[model samples]
Target chain A: MSELELQNKKAAAFVSTETIDGEIATLNLGPTHPATHGIFQNILQVDGERILSAEQTVGYIHRAFEKLAERRPYNQIAPITDRLNYCSSPINNMGWHMTVEKLIGAEMPKRVDYMRVIVMELARIADHLVCNSVIGVDTGALTGFTYMFQEREKIYDIYEEICGARLTTNVGRIGGFDRDFNKEFITKLRAFLKEFPKKFDEFGALLERNRIFMDRTIGAGPISAERALSYSFAGPNLRAAGVDYDVRVMKPYSSYQDFDFNIPVGNDGDTYDRFMVRQQEIRESLKIIHQALENMPQGDYHADIPSFYLPPKEEVYSSMEALIYHFKIVMGETPIPQGEVYHSVEGGNGELGYYLVSDGGRTPYRLHFRRPCFIYYQAYPEMITGSLLSDAILTMSSMNVIAGELDA
Target chain B: MSEFATKIKDSILEKYNNTSYELDTYGEHNFICSKNDIHAVVEFLKNEGFIFLTDLTGSHYPESEGAEFQVVYHIHNLAENVRFRLKVDLAQNDLHVPTLTDLFAGANWMERETFDFFGIIFEGHPNLTRILNVDDMDYHPMKKEYALEDETRTDKDDTFFGR
Candidate 1:
């Protein structure tokens, strides 16, 4: 036998021997199973259809992003952030940019801030649509998944209009956007805003009150609020457990304070509650997007930080000053302060924090991404310890543990 | 500083003696304590309503004398909306700190990730195995001494790539 096969056999023997009851079986859920949304392996000890205990083995897609960030320059690191939680790449991009901006103390213009808000909220909707609809698919309702995926495509169209990329969007810059939102982008966004709610409501109707969906998700993977807090749950997961703590409200960044919205909370921290909380959040994100668009300011979209922000391509080709500035930025010659800063944004998943430490170098001395998926995935085995095997799949979908973010 | 932060800072200073620990308000309120007293400080902070362990990770500084590895903790009090950082520095020879798993269950994987990357031993952790890396990987990849790229990859050699 191969080394891996022998090791697996030994592990299975060890697990079988450890079981107290007779006829207990061990099952490997995946590093590549369809039910496991991403590449994560869960070795579950089962007594028939019920799971006795589960041990998760992550890192199949570990990219060593933190290690890689140490070699790349500050501005070039934005593309790397895009790969983490690719479902909402813009939020990751904006969070990293805002972290660098925080380190440099660059005050962004109101127009730039509002524009960022709109983009972030649209990304939020895309993230929630995938999460909620996938939860439906895991519960054996695949129609909602297909229906909401079309709306997700519409959001992708808006993203393409903004940054010319669909999925792993390396959008925005350190100080602000690379370019302004054009008339076409605005028109598409308006069309998306007009059409998405009806589709969202219809999708909700398909799964919200359905008897089978309710029974599958209501108490299948329930966790107490206190336990959830101990696990450092954030975003919709924590909010679903009745905690009103949101990074946006707790520490508002990128003009989030100006937007009026409500923080949705749920009494029970279960699959159904998580689904409902995200559903309500989609509505709130829509409200925020509408507010951001209505109150959009008329001024410079990109911040006026010449040392950090790149000059226009047209100017770079003609003007000597602009050419020099462009060359300086592209070469990563801008001076960085020797200090540390922690900036967290209300990401699609949760509190996406960037802890950056600089030593007056071109590259970051050390950078850590506080990925929420990683934090909450730790609580999975604990939450689903006594639940059924089928329920575990439902719980995994509800957690929205993006493998990239979890492993990064 | 806000009253909430000040109260916690004062309590730590008064209890530990101000000279024993270094305190600063650089980004977040940072308290650099000895590795020996980290558990006590965490316990004190937990009792002081810093119930949320937001993040726990390690950073390596090869040049810093006597402080080779710094394990930083970002703790938050949800009710008070206050967050502060606590750091414990360890030398190369003694790279061990008390585990916070007893206080916060989430610290299990965080400590494992730290141990996996930087090789900082969290004493008293239940299962301190590598979380994000393969089990057989030998070296701590995040330490400053380690190169970011693989040396064994011959495809991207300088001669072939024309560096």
Candidate 2:
């Protein structure tokens, strides 16, 4: 058979009869598989197992968060934000509420603001811990994952102690927190802080010097700073490319300006660079969390607005006004002013923003989430272009491409 | 404020032959520009050292008369530490714009998302297929038109497990 005949025969095997040639064989990764993370499908044009091009087919996890937020009231959308990056629900909670608050010209108390910063930073640490640990596991270092999971469990325990829920924490209300942080919560946080640094150091020591781990990650998924920037990469992915662009420092939402911490950047912009960046960021998050917690202001955790923030149970039962306001806010009776605002906060992934438009009604006119995973995932093929299949998995795991965030 | 964004408003106005650019500053060098003349405007910005196309997305306003889709871009300049947003509005009928993928290689998924949600067509986008929807589905699920009948229906039908 001629070269053209063999090419035609190979093309016919694919469901979509499209073919590309560059001395590479074609491969399909997954539409359904555990390692693919979620329902993501990737069609790779390969040359001797070296991927020449990788076309990603996502939407396996699309929940249409933007469309759903349109029908729900500003406050009712908190739960929806939780679902977007389900791994870091509190950050999404804070991001969504803060965006709405900015739209409504709502100013939270200093204490409430500081508390939000602490919670958000904690969430960032938790997310990075999961990301780094998973990358280790993907690279055949299972012990690191086990060690990190122990610490993450402690963090989740603190989350449960503070909010009642572990993963899907609808913790933040519109104006402020759902409630105050008690002494027990503070004590647990302090305990976690005391032990966390040592555990982080141990985890770092376990993987940082391991030759196998270093070899697997060092040059894998190397993207130039210019390429990283153009790809709209945010969080550790962008930071790995040597840019000091952090939303918290750049914009300073939720009083992130009050705390002082350095934004770590990597020189090479590879899988190893991303790993180091995330590792350093986790340390920085701890610093921010500690500073915020120590300097936490002395004031009401919830905002003074009776209509927006839920009233205390005592006030709810005693006062008819409180009862009525509670019913009104819960039932979406409060009139939402017409306007639009784009609010972006530095999430575990990168810049997690909520672009909200209101139409003087209870429900929103529009709600669009600028998700980091969606942007970072775009660079997957470029990162894995000349690398092995295992390198692709390590690169993806290092990037921490959370399916919930990507598909949202 | 970063150098690139500080002079961006004046530069944009000058480059576009005196077209007024609404340059709203958020933090240091964060500027938001209106969608009018955005493609040409961004091309100039990219050439002048604001090379990073950090984010691109779309939001829908059902109440607005004709102008429904609003696409936003978050850009950064690595050398200058500048960040900004460039927004362009598209009507339902004229939901087309030139693809920025030529300038920013990372815009592949973001443009697909903008296409997925608001149905904004990128004229030069390579593969503008349904990214987060069923290949056979007709409507853009992110629009207000595709409202769900029940809350539970979302859990069973819209995501990976959706039929």
Candidate 3:
């Protein structure tokens, strides 16, 4: 046969006259698709309604955070961290602060630690609420998403009371918080504590045992514990696989050891298990917040490091020492110790680690963020290979692959 | 160093006598091994219960002659709740390192990312291509020689931003 004829015959085999109507199709679940919550592309090779294979293409929103962190000062980098995993921005801020503190060996006071616990738990609640509600929306249950989003707004209100910003909250300082939790902040938190559980339970009752929801999610996108661990899954996703690995429990930081809670795990490691694990985690986070508020300690909010922490604005205007310190800090002249440290925190999604390498300079020589979503999203193609097209959307929502964190 | 880390260090020292390696501690134990022995050392650590590969990233050191690129691996032993770092330094002229994809499938994109940013080639990566950056770009952006911000912008002057 001629070369052209040979090529035509091979191409014709895939779409023979008999099989043309039932031929496999290629669907570009492109970045602009609505089902993909964030800006990411996945090309799915589907045979009718079933996806035969999937190829993910991320980096649609890569902002190069690691490169930016190397140039910014240690204190200035906290705001940059806020952009990562913006659903739980405060957790990112606190995690970055703790990483720098670890590098400097600065110990925070008990009160500071407790306050951080409260803020971080609230952030966790907000993050999980979004994930679970979005999963509901993806599964054709829109009312629950609307109902839970109100609770997310309330959590944002609490964040606003603590920090001026709501979503990307640059809340904490290097050693501790920039300000104390005010009386209004405490009242709002108490109100949220009093009312959130009832709403959470109502939301849970709506989907937890509903026949249709269960049928849609029970065995959808299942991963074995061994496979999940091999992919370095963390946070609720790993727990859903029955590994029982919680960074807060394993290597406690920011007074997490003092709080009492259970790490929820599931057997099937399916979408339903991931949803249940996050639902259980919401209750656990509430318990931790209540404990933290009740046992709130008495001390300064921020550490007394003039060189690292900025002084009050009034003091900076009046005192020569404060003014010099302010200039030095703003100009990125603060001296950092020559060392390296890796600090991991139990973020809303998983283990959010900041690896810092300092050369006794004003800025970090290298700062690498171990973003959990980025790692876990790598397993999405594997998980969704044999599942249906609709099930892939549910799995993506269940995985909660926040683009900010994934492409950072 | 913890007992497990000590044991791993002793094993590496015994197995690779001619190679130069260093042990450093900051927050976790770090074993900086020679470039050629990284795959074997990581395989050895995996056998030693460091089953979870937590992270894989690369750093650039422009001034460090003969060793300008460093690949850092963070691995953990879940049973003991212990974590350690393994680093292998690569020379600038020869930026090739053996791929870890055969051992841990999660290293696929990370190695691509390392290659994307630092231009450190993972020799046996199944699909070695640009991950985060556009494929047509000629230079690695993360190396120290590149500017942090875009220099082409005329809107924000250096003095205005206090640079």
Best-performing candidate as measured by DockQ: 3
TM-score of each: 0.94, 0.88, 0.94
How far off is residue A199 in model 1, in Å?
1.1
Higher DockQ: candidate 2 or 3? 3
Candidate 1 docking category?
medium
lDDT of 3 at A114: 96
Best by lDDT: 1
Give lDDT tens digits, candidate 1, residues B17-72: 52144444354788888887789988988998889999999999999989989999
Q: Compared to the true structure, candidate 1 yields what TM-score?
A: 0.94
Q: Which pairs, if any, clash in model 1?
A: none
Better of 2 and 3 by lDDT: 3
Candidate 1 per-residue lDDT over residues A58-83, each given as its tens digit: 99999999999998889999999999
Indicate the fraction of true inter-chain contacts that candidate 2 also forms. Answer: 0.75
For candidate 1, give the DockQ: 0.50
Model 2 gets an lDDT of 0.78
Docking class of 2: acceptable
